[model samples]
Target: MNKDIRNLSDRIEAVFPKMVQLRREFHQAPELSFHEEKTPARVAEILQALGLKVRTKVGGRGVVAVLEGGKPGRTVALRADMDALPIQDEKVCDYRSKVPGVMHACGHDGHTAALLGVAEILAGMREDIAGRFVLLFQHAEELVPGGAQEMIADNALDGVDAIYGVHLWTPFPYGVVGLRAGTLMAAADSFRIEVIGKGGHGGLPHKTTDAIVIASHLIVNLQSIISRQVDPLQSGVISVGHINGGQAFNVIAERCTIEGTVRSFDQEVRQFIKQQMERVIEQTCQMYGAQFELKYGWGYPPVVNDSSETTRMAAMARRIVGDDNVWEIPPLMTGEDFSYYLQKVPGCFAMVGAGNEEKGFIYPHHHPHFDFDERVMKTAAELLIRSGLGYLSADSPEVTVGNLYR
Candidate 1:
């Protein structure tokens, strides 16, 4: 690493304790998706303490802090989500979530803490920095119709030239950075199928059209839509995560509900899956002599990173954490609303490895036991702040917002 960056990395290390303390505090009292109250307030307070202009209740519970540097240049944005999942915290630790039935199982706490660390550190060195920095503490990333839409609608990225975000992933081992050029994450869509049929006594011979039976058939048929219809080379998933109906074992169910999610990288394949699902539901209901109601909700688009940005970010990552630590990986089936921001500006969403089996933080995201090495927050901060500087440097070719300081 160069002298400047090595100094910056040391500065991030200096704030590592604050990042850990703040992360623990956030984890101890997490707020759920779309219902955040204290998290945003706390974030705004911290940013305000840094003497930066902070905007709160942004798009309802989202907070944005703008840091204008002492020098003149373009604008860059960094984002971190502030919402937690609905799962109960089952981990036995001092930082275990105090919010009953709500926890930060997805490493969002770490993301927020890392960004806040960056903001505090950068705020101290504003003169050396050329461009303004917009730190977005987004809400409700765990739920659809995510906060990214609301923030962007509220002009969060009004004068932003580029944006970047990170996720502290446990799947990758510690010190590893996962970066991909295109389709870093999939586009996720959810579907709900409701089957309506006749109710009758179980002892009666063929007296009722069983909705549960119809739902079962529909689930099986939905599998074929992706398995048999989609090309072998293409990737897609259609799993029925939930099913409900039938109160009694002897009585036939009059209605049944099935809910599942679809994930795909290709838009054509995404549309094709939806179409095939509709066809399968219609035909399956007809075959079972039942009626059906289907609800398919489109979710965030796939996270497609700009090739140039990914390359540039990768080069910076190598300098920060050596060549062996930087890695180019395949696309994941998971989804992120960071895709929303990427849609507005050329950005890259990279993952900082937090998994450490020796540390017993090996659980995957969204799991009740999910946790990570908090030290990874330092890596996250170094990458986010340095990458932003690299992009906003006066000599950089991609001088996106040099004139738009507002």
Candidate 2:
């Protein structure tokens, strides 16, 4: 490693303990989407302590901190989500969530801590920083019409040349950093359907319009939209995860509700599936003489990485983790609100491996038992700072757009 890089590595190691403590504090007091009252305040206080100009409650309980470097150049934004899931923490650990039915099962705690660590590192080297750094601690990433949209509405991307985000992913083994040039994650959309019918005795099926039966048919036909309606070359998913209906075994259900998620990488395919699903529900209900209501909510879009930005970020990753540990993998089915940031400006969202089966950190995100190796937070922080600095120090426009690195 270069002498400067080695020195930065040492600095990051020295702050690793602080990062762990921050992550633990967040884990113990996990907050849910849009209801993150305390999380944003805590983030604002920390950023203020770093001597950065902080903006509180920019958009839906988010905090934005701006650090102006000594030199003049473009502006780069680094983001971290600070909300938790509704799942109750099942792991018996010291830092487990104290709030019932709420936990940071998605590793947002680690992401927040890592971004704080990056802030510490970059703030210390303000003289060497050529451009300004914008630190965004976002909220409600797990919910639809994500916090990113609100933040952008409040001018979060104004005057920003580029943006970046990181996720502590458990699917990959520890020490691996995943990156890709094109779409890295799928678009997530959800749907809810209500089949309404007349109730009657279960024994006399001919006298009643069975809502449960209609819902069952609708569920099965929804899958056909993905497999039969969509082109085979394209990928799509229509999964019905929830079903609620009848109260008694001898009574026919008057209404049944079904809820599920839709995921796709292509916009055309995503729209096609939505239309097909509505068609199936309408036609199926008509066939059974039942009334139906359907609601489709569009969530996060697919996170598409700019080729130039991804290539430059990958080069920085190789420098930190060696060539073998850096991977350009295929797109995943998971959705992220970071796609919103990418929609406005060029950015790359990298997945940092935090999974370690030996240490019981193998569970997937949103799982009650999900946990991650804290050491990866150091790698995450270092990578963010390295990418930010690399983009700033280079003088050429191509370098800023992610062609050549300093």
Computed on alpha carbons, the lDDT of every model, listed in order, comes to 0.90, 0.89
For all candidates, what are the clash counts? 1, 0
Residue by residue across 1-406, what tens digits does model 2's lDDT show? 1345568988999889999999999999999999998989988898899999999888878899999998889999999999999999999899999999999999999999999988887788787677899998999999887798999999888888988788999998889899898899999999899999989999999999999999999988888887788889889888898999999999999999999999999998988888888789999999999999998999899999988778767777777888889988889999999998998999899999999999999899999999999999988998888777777765424345553322
How well does each candidate superpose onto the true structure, as a TM-score?
0.96, 0.96
TM-score of 2: 0.96
Model 2, residue 61: what's the lDDT?
87
For model 2, the stretches where C-alpha displacement exceeds 4 angstroms are 1-4, 395-406
Q: RMSDs, each prediction? A: 4.0, 2.4
Residue 365, model 1, lDDT? 98
| Per-residue lDDT over 68-148 for candidate 1, one digit per residue giving the tens place of the 0 to 100 score | 998888999999999999999999998999989999999999999999999999987887778899999999999998999
Error of 1 at 217 (Å): 1.4
